[model samples]
Each structure stands twice: as structure tokens, then as C-alpha cells.
Target: MTHIVDAAWQKILTTYGEPVPPDASPLLEPFAVLARVAHAEPLLRRLHPWTGMWELHFSRCTEMNYTWDLPYIGTLRDGRYYVEGPDRSSPRIAETDSAQAAVAMVVDRLPPGCGPAFLGNAGELAAYEKTRDQG
Candidate 1:
């Protein structure tokens, strides 16, 4: 259930106040709430931006696919890892031999004080700390 309240979509909803139809999938209920929040307060944006990273556990040609959390940073697709954020451009984290190594790069940056460890791409961990502390 990787439902994201995209900021871009929120802007459209705010400007036009469009009607959101009943979703056929119940799993999307949680996401709809977030969407509504975004639509109402488009400037609020995302407090926790690194929330929607997931992995496709299994994808069969004509069978039900499985999904799970990555528990790391960014997304891995087409044999490459990418660090994505709304405020920043999606940079290629790595294209290494070990998947674990790629994930390590992201995990190492999740905490505060990890300055320039990976180029401070995501607003420096300290910035996150300041907001967290204020909240």
C-alpha cells in the first residue's frame, strides 16, 4: 500500500477544488486522507519525505505481485539505485555489484551529524534534526 500524497497533485486539487471519486481499492483510503491534506494545505508539503520507498518482492508475468519495504534509502530499479526527493533531483545513488552496499550509502545518511558523508544531498541530516527538535 504505497500511497503517496504527491505535492504536485495537491496543487491541482487546491486550485480547482476537484472532486475525488470513491476509490475501488480500499487500501488507498489512507492515501486519500493524505491527499486531502495536501490539497487543503499544499504548502505544508511532506514532513517526512522519505516514506514511500518500497521494493517489488515478486513480479510474475501473469500472477499477483508482492511488495515490501526497502528499509533503507531511495529506490532500486533497472539494476540501479536512486535517491529521490521532492525538493531535490533524483540522483543515482549507485550502480554497484552489491545491493547491500547501495542501501548502506542511504542508511548512513539517515541520521544527523552525517555531514557530507554522501554530499548532504537531502538537506543535511542536521536540518532534519533542527525541525525534529523544534517540533
Candidate 2:
């Protein structure tokens, strides 16, 4: 089963002094856990478009899962943490520490307007923040 998060409705509640849905599951719970380990580090507190989603765009020229079952997270035989997104190319993120910190480093290093497109979801963003807190 899939979980849906009504972020816009929640925003309305906060702004209009309405009650939040008591049944609302914390959004991005599963994905955040994966993104935490996959991208490492978690969301940036100061970043704009603050949905806190962690996004990775794969090259169209590469051969791999473009969207589904992609962004594989694991260790090489040498014991380094790495994630292979839909691009089929593997990018090593960290070794001695959790990769979440590395993700933060990456986002920090991006030039203006050079960031990825998948990082805009608010639920995902919140999940990233939650992941950082848990780690």
C-alpha cells in the first residue's frame, strides 16, 4: 500500500489555525531512511524550496533503472559506501561515516542553479531532516 501526505492541507491548517489530520502518517518515512543511507547526511536547514527531498538525476545515456529500483546503496568489496542511481554510474559517497553528511557536502558544493530537480518535495525534505536527526 502507498501512503499519501497532504502537505498543502497541513500548510493550510498551520496558517489558518486548523487542526492537522491526526491520521496523517509522517511523510517520507521509508524513502527518508533509504535516502539517508543512499545520499547520506540529510537535508540542509538553509536550502530553499524547502520540501527537503533528496533527488538524483541519472544520465539518459547510461544503462540502468531510470526511476524504479534505482539509486542502489551498498558497499564495494573494499568496504566503501556507494550509491548507483539510475545513471548506472556509481558514485562513492563515504567510507568511515554515514553518507548523509556527504550528501550535505554535495548540496553545499553545488553552484547556483546547478542543483538536481528531484529535491523539491516537502515530504521528502522533511524526511531528510528527520533522517539527519535520527543519525
- Each candidate's number of clashing pairs is 0, 9
lDDT of 2 by residue, 47-130 (tens): 221112223322111112212222333333333334443234555443433346434444554445432233335355456658
Where's the lowest-lDDT run of ten residues in candidate 1? Answer: 55-64
lDDT of 2: 0.33
What's the TM for model 2?
Answer: 0.26
Candidate 1: deviation at residue 125, Å? 15
TM-score each candidate.
Answer: 0.26, 0.26
Candidate 2 lDDT score at position 133: 77
